[model samples]
Target: MESTQVHTLNLTSVLSVSKKIILTRYWHFVSLSILLFFPLSFSLINISSIIHLFTDDHSNNHKLLITYLLIVYILALCAIGAISYSTHHDFFGEPVKFFDSLKSLTFSFLPITSTAIIAHVIICLISLTFILLVGTILMLVHNLGFVVIDYNSVYFMWFLVIMGVILIAIVLYFYVEWSLAFVVVVVESKWGFAALMRSSYLVKGMRSVSLLVMLYFWGCGVLIVLICSTNMHAIVITTLGSFFFTMFLLRITAANTVLYNYCKALHGELELEVGEGFVHEYMNIPSEN
Candidate 1:
């Protein structure tokens, strides 16, 4: 009975276990590299966006925003891939090199990363379209310009607002569930939408925990940056703010990678080693420490 109880207690939630792994010195160095590399990468990527922002044509600002998003999204995927790949190396007690992780972005990683970014952009467009539809209906109703029946329009506006909130909530949940797709892409060498499908599969029954972990880290990072922005010097704020934000990203990536492994373990899928390529044959599942 005591042994059974011990076995049950050993199966702690992945978040709790992963928190320990992410904080270790081995992973911290990899995360630090990511934190340092991000700003330099962002500056290079932002050149075109800054040029667009300063252009005389304010009417094309929407197009500029889309262009900026495309640039940022592509760079963000590469950064994520680099960081997550490095963490995977350290997780398995392998010798981790920065360039090796960057090189690991080949195979299914880049394609899946591109696909995930495109999918996110699509989701944003769909959400924007819904918002526009709501605005259009409101406009048409107002143009009808009913005086006595204006109360009906007001009520309908409230309903639309509520619907907008609900739609946002649903999208948030969907995003959370699919958040680990990149990790799956790297680990399993899955291509394109297939990686997303694998991520959706692995995230089953874990959405609440995933959402909470993300919010906790991101909220803390935002709060720290906000405080620094208010009270610190510009240089201090820029340096320290970026540090905290990068740390948050690093930790989140690590935790999600750990979660991915745990889910694969649960499903009896073979675990990929740090330097191992994807193989079809299932190996015996190892006991988790």
Candidate 2:
């Protein structure tokens, strides 16, 4: 009976923490946060088009978009890199001035700058492979019409291939989604080896919360796109995609801040160890939250 009571309390605590996070708003930093992600998404979509262009040659002009995409992507990365040291500002759940926090975030990330370079390299390699794989798939679809009865018709191969693609999407989603926490680990925690692992530990039981947060951001992004589309689809797509990516980055940044604070406290780097009753303390808002 005592153990059952403990279990109920634990569940209640998790729910409360999740609710607290959801209720909190960061309207002040929304635009800056969006800036963090916009270029990367455009770069990705542009890469896809570039691959299709090379393989099909049907839309040769789109190569220009790819060039623009890569150039913009590189510039955005450089901008983030420039400000990487300033990402660590937290004033107890209160709104922070963006420039001040940006400065802090950059300094906080200094310890892992080299590691970040390595990670970026790995991602670039994977992106190249991904483009190649996408090109291969497109080539197969165009040359080998064995799976199609009519131009728009599909046979079993089409369904099977579609299923395969959906499965791949699910895998990619989980892979990227989980690692979103790593950047936080990179900056706020000084220790290199333990930073990423610490984030993984903190995020361990919070997968459901993370997924819901991602979904909410995605939906909000959709609404923004709709609003912007009323003016111009191209402009709105660019704006909406950027907004979604920025929010995504900010959430990762915020989640890492919370986790790093908690772990630092646990490791005696900070003054307290915040656990199940973490939020009940006065300093919870000041130091831990």
- lDDT of every predicted structure (CA atoms): 0.61, 0.46
Q: Estimate each model's TM-score.
A: 0.69, 0.48
The clash count of every prediction, one per candidate, is 0, 15
lDDT of 1 by residue, 1-289 (tens): 1222212222234445455555555454444445444553333324344455656476555666557656665656766676667666555555466567767767645676676766678689878887888778767777887523354577767886798897888788777868788887777677567777778898776666668777777677667656655644465655666566666666677777766765555554534441365321111222245
Question: In model 1, where do residues sit more than 4 Å from their true spots?
Answer: 1-16, 26-37, 40-73, 132-161, 231-233, 270-289
- Specify the poorest-scoring 10-residue window by lDDT in model 2: 1-10
Global fold similarity of model 2 (TM-score): 0.48
**How far out, in Å, is residue 258 in model 1?**
0.8
lDDT value, candidate 2, whole model: 0.46
Top model number, TM-score: 1
Cα RMSD (angstroms) for every candidate in the order listed: 6.8, 8.6
Per-residue alpha-carbon lDDT of model 2 for 127-219, expressed as tens digits?
567667765776698689754334355664685577568655654454334343344544545434454444455445444444545455455
